[model samples]
Target: MECVFCHIVRGEAAAHLVYEDRAVVAFLDARPLFEGHVLVVPREHLPTLTDLPPQLLGPYYAVVRRLAGAVQTAMGAEGSFVAANNRVSQSVPHFHTHVVPRRRKDGLRGFFWPRGRYPDAARAAEVARRVREVVSADGAG
Candidate 1:
């Protein structure tokens, strides 16, 4: 079976994509912790962050950094939470960085997982577009 994220990266699966380039692709999380939550992944099918090639690290994280700012701005968030899991807690085996929009007292607490979904596909697409706009304007896309 092919990795779902690899499918997304290859345009073989549907995703609310916010950013894409030769090295990485970013899209909205189907199950998000908050509105505008995005997942950044490499084009290659690396299983974990540690598995990412050293040459790709700078380029990969550069996109993550850009998306972190764009997601916060697009969501009108006070800040953003960026995280990654190794093999232990990774829902998908493919490597990814979660960029979650955050606000003061938004009910997320340390080490506690709370997940939510967009009310509809239209809503999710709108959120992705907003993030994409910011990323494009910032010259990160």
Candidate 2:
């Protein structure tokens, strides 16, 4: 219950949710390296990538693939940076994949750690909802 991403998935906490399905939820990162940086997370609170169930792997990656394209296309970025953390640098206890929008020499150098906050919760939720709409129609997660 203390896991923040879990609360977000349940709508118990505010998040910029862009995509959802049976297995996964994708949302805007509260503090991001770029405006459209998104977090694709599993619905079940798996603590790390190695903790993921084998049955859920396909569905999860499908959602991530969809969101990667959405982040680039929707945010008008030339490319995308898709990555995840295990125990190290894992901000939340739950597992998550980062789908960040990228441009050439956009000052996102190094470990891609620069972060920024949303101007307001409404804006964050709005962006997340919009992303959700795009990824939802692609197929079932």
Candidates' TM-scores?
0.78, 0.77
Give the range where candidate 2 is weakest over 10 consecutive residues by summed lDDT: 132-141
lDDT of 2 by residue, 45-88 (tens): 99999899889999999999999998999999999999999998
Which candidate has the top score in TM-score? 1
lDDT assessment of candidate 2:
0.91
- Clash pairs, candidate 1, are none
**What is candidate 1's CA lDDT for residue 82?**
96
Estimate the overall C-alpha local distance difference test score of candidate 1.
0.95
Which residue ranges in model 2 land beyond 4 Å of their true spot?
Answer: 110-141
For candidate 2, report its TM-score: 0.77
Per-candidate local distance difference test: 0.95, 0.91
